[model samples]
Target: MRVITVEEHFHHPEVGPRVMDLSGPPPIDLDADFSTFWRNFTPDRELAEQLAGGRLEHMDAAGINIQVLSHGAMTPGSLDHPDATGLCRQVNDWLAEQISQYPTRFRGFATVPLYDPKAAADEMRRCIDELGFVGTLTQGTFAGLFLDDPRFEPVLAAAEELNSPLYVHPGIPPASVLRAYYSGNWPASVEFLLSSPAFGWHAEAGIHILRLILSGALDRHPGLKLLSGHWGEMVAGWLDRLDEAIGWGHYLDRPVSDYYRTQVWITPSGMYSHNQLKFFLAEVGADRIIHSEDFPYVVRTNVADFLLNADIADHEREAIAHRNAEALLRISPL
Candidate 1:
């Protein structure tokens, strides 16, 4: 099977310093930087080489045929950062450069400088129309403001018109949550900081997509396609209840699950829980499922083995491995 993994990630080494230069003082994330996690996850030298070099050989070894590259998690700054547009351009250019050298084995997700919505929409158009990008990845929010903010509607409209799906990744919970709630020690900050990537991250991403749903972005931009990782970021299986709660106040244009089923796509993202996959498949069906590995951050395992060995029917497994990605991404079958 040809494997086309989305959510493969890379980082520009200079991104931090540049964002700091333009973003004024950085957030707490910059100071603490979660070095403890990133250090062990990617390390420095090998990750640098992976970003600077190529991963075709590694993909071949692992039976991953292609990777749609995205910025690691969220882009590391507020959208209000003064140089957000420039930083976005630099990131997108670098992504395009990396993919250009290995077009057959890689694809690019454009970054839009979203501090300025007009500029972001324009950039989205350029990246897709001119740069041949597959789509763009916007993490949970630009700072705390979800993309459902009216300012960002143009970007959503542009994404739909251009046929570029928007992949919404997770972002950090507020610093207030970290400071007052999750601060310090095993049951608190330590566990939150560690487990957030697994559980908390999914909740945050789910909420963000939920905002897109309840905030009526999906209703306005009916053609919009939203992608989320970790089995639809906890939204896939619980649609009936989600709609039930939301519908208590006012009727939505459609049920929350209907919007989700039509507008959202999910990926496994190196999270290899057999039960989770089966449950997710049952909830969301196989059409909205796609392949992902979360790349260097979770690089030890082979996703191909998960696809081949997971307790799923052959056709469903084939869809998750590559067929769905091919249709969603508009790529020719190998």
Candidate 2:
């Protein structure tokens, strides 16, 4: 199978440290082995910084033919930093340079400074038109304001005009939300995990996409395409309920699920469960599904085996493996 993973990540070693630090307090739990957990789960920094040799070798070992790389944890800094315009430009330039080195084995997703809508739009244009990036990635929200906030219209407009899909990766919840909702239930370690990857992050990304639909952002920018990780950030399972509940209000031009059908795409992001594959295939169909490993952070034992052995037709497997990504991101198939 010609596998093309779209949610792989890269960290710009030189530029990462300069961004403002918004990461909240470290885990203070005394009960859980937080240190050991992170030690095992944290991605290797050297591997993340190496675009040519180390990463490529790992891909070869795992049978990944292509990786669509985007900035990882530091991605939100582009929107939070005071000098985001310059920082985002530098970040995108460096990523473009890296992709140029392994043009066929690698692809890029632009990192834009969503804090400045006009600058974000210009950078998205430059990355897609000039740098040859397939699209852009956003780490959910910036300064607690989701993209549906009217201030981000220019970025949405640019995405539509440029025909670029915005990959909505999960971002850390703001401090206030962290304190109010996710804290106090258990050990700080559990709280931290709950507020992030274990639960909060996916919920936040799902809400972000729904806000784009409900807040009229998608209606205004109808041509804009959205890519969500972790099986549409849990939205794939809830579309029916969402459409049912939102139908009571009936605010938009169509049902909430219609936007998902037309404008959204989803990837497993390393959640390689056959049950999930079966459910998502039934819920959204094969066309809306794509492939990803969520790389380094989510290193699966059976990297390619899940899709390779899916209980589906050959064409469906091919679509999830590479064809859907090729069509969505305009990547040329090998």
Candidate 3:
């Protein structure tokens, strides 16, 4: 099957620059050998040989178009890594270049420095207006402030104005939390997966998103779209609990599920459980679920197979593999 891979990933050769104070403790050794780190962190050769090379053979093998997000390149250490304005320009320029290279098979999501909302908004505009990017991808939090912070209103406003979505992927936690996680000799490999969007769901990310909803951001700008990867960090399972809390008059005036179904979408990246997928679809609806492969770092061959072989009807499969992402990105069918 020809699949429109909306959530494919690519790493920049240089990802060490964009690191912020929020990524938790520096991975064990700040001075670790760069060459070895790059080899492990990047997906260039592997991805090229595997999916890009058409290595996985099946009669109905799924072919994917890529949408490159950031690797670790924009980390605080990268060359063009700017304070704010410079970062935006660098990312916008990079996205424009990607579009030029893969005009048809590739699309890009802008990586902006969320630490500064004004800078983020400007970069998003440049990426969308000039570079033709569908949306922006950002680490879960900037500095210590999560996305729900009022400071991010400008960025969200800009996205709403442009009718573009904001893709929120996981990043390391703040320095304090990093210390706690690291003190246990917890491997980042295991910890990052276990902690991410799920942790964010309970901690700052969920709070901020809830606040955003209650603050009327979605209501004011109905066109605004948001994408959460890692199956919304397990948000599907907890919606009812949150909804119940809200119904019992906790923080917001209305039910939290109302905002979720109306304004938010989730990508099935690491989530492959069919029952879970069905559950999410039942709760959030299929139109809001898009296909994602955490990619490179986590090879997506299995996910591709799972979606292709699933027992769902043709329309459901099509909706998840391509249609939903197209709608969110506003990309016309090819």
Candidate 4:
């Protein structure tokens, strides 16, 4: 069966100039210039070499159609704030252009100006109507507000109305968090992986998602689709604990697992372990899972091999490899 790798990722070099303005004196190293670190950290030549060596091709051999999520404006400084509609327009144009280049091999997700809900909503409409993007991708938190903030209601509402999925990926750390890690001489490479799972995934992603659920966002917008990265960011493992917490008359008013199973979907990007995949499938039906390589950050060849060879039933393997994403993205079967 042909598979659609719905969670592949790519970064645009122009994202640096388009998202940031470096005219002013470089602020602090950890806080202000972290964007520079991320941009410089991943060398394009290395990525090109991998792709050229048939690494990505191997995934194609496994019947996977790569769906690339074009890198968008990273927030920090004067570059491209979420409230900047003009910047969003430019980014949307870039994403559309990227998709056009590989119509069969790629599809795109839009980045909207999240600082302003009206602007975000407007840009989302344009991305869907004009650019034909599958959905919009956002950071776990924007500026300082979590996804559940009332300010973002319009953006969420628009996505639901348009039937577009919302892909939430990890971004830079908050100022306070960055300070602690930097002062401790912590390597970002290490800190990012650890913090994303330990802190952001649980505190920010989980809490915000729960807020959306309890607030009746999903109940109101039942068609809303949410895609999370890093194998659901440990959400699968937390289900039983979450149920225990909720059952014990904890903070959440409803069963946490209900929201997880019904309203959200997760991608197997950056996670390739058989046990992890199996756990996610058992906890949140295989249909809620999608395939992703977190490419450019992860070695594509290794991921393709892992997914293809994982010890799962043929049907479940096919579902995670491509079927779930196709259904979620509304992409026709190959």
TM-score of each: 0.90, 0.94, 0.81, 0.83
Give me candidate 1's TM-score against the actual structure: 0.90
Cα RMSD of predicted structure 1? 2.7
The most accurate candidate by TM-score is 2
**CA lDDT of every candidate:** 0.78, 0.85, 0.63, 0.67
Best by lDDT: 2
Query: Compared with the true structure, what per-residue lDDT tens digits does model 4 show for residues 246-297?
Result: 6786655468788788878888776678888887878898888888876655
The order by descending TM-score is 2, 1, 4, 3
Local accuracy of candidate 1 as per-residue lDDT tens digits, 1-334:
8888999887776775566565453234433545655556553444533543436656877788888887774474245676788888888887788778777888888888778888888888888888888898887567568888898888898999988899998866666554554455444335455436746667878888999998889988888999999888878878989888988977687889999998899998888888988888888898889989887777635779888888889999899988988888887897
Q: lDDT value for candidate 1?
A: 0.78
lDDT of 3: 0.63
Backbone clash pairs in model 2 (N, Cα, C under 3 Å; residues 3+ apart or in different chains), count: 0
Residue 31 error, candidate 2, Å: 11
> What's model 4's TM-score?
0.83
Worst 10 residues of 3 by lDDT: 51-60
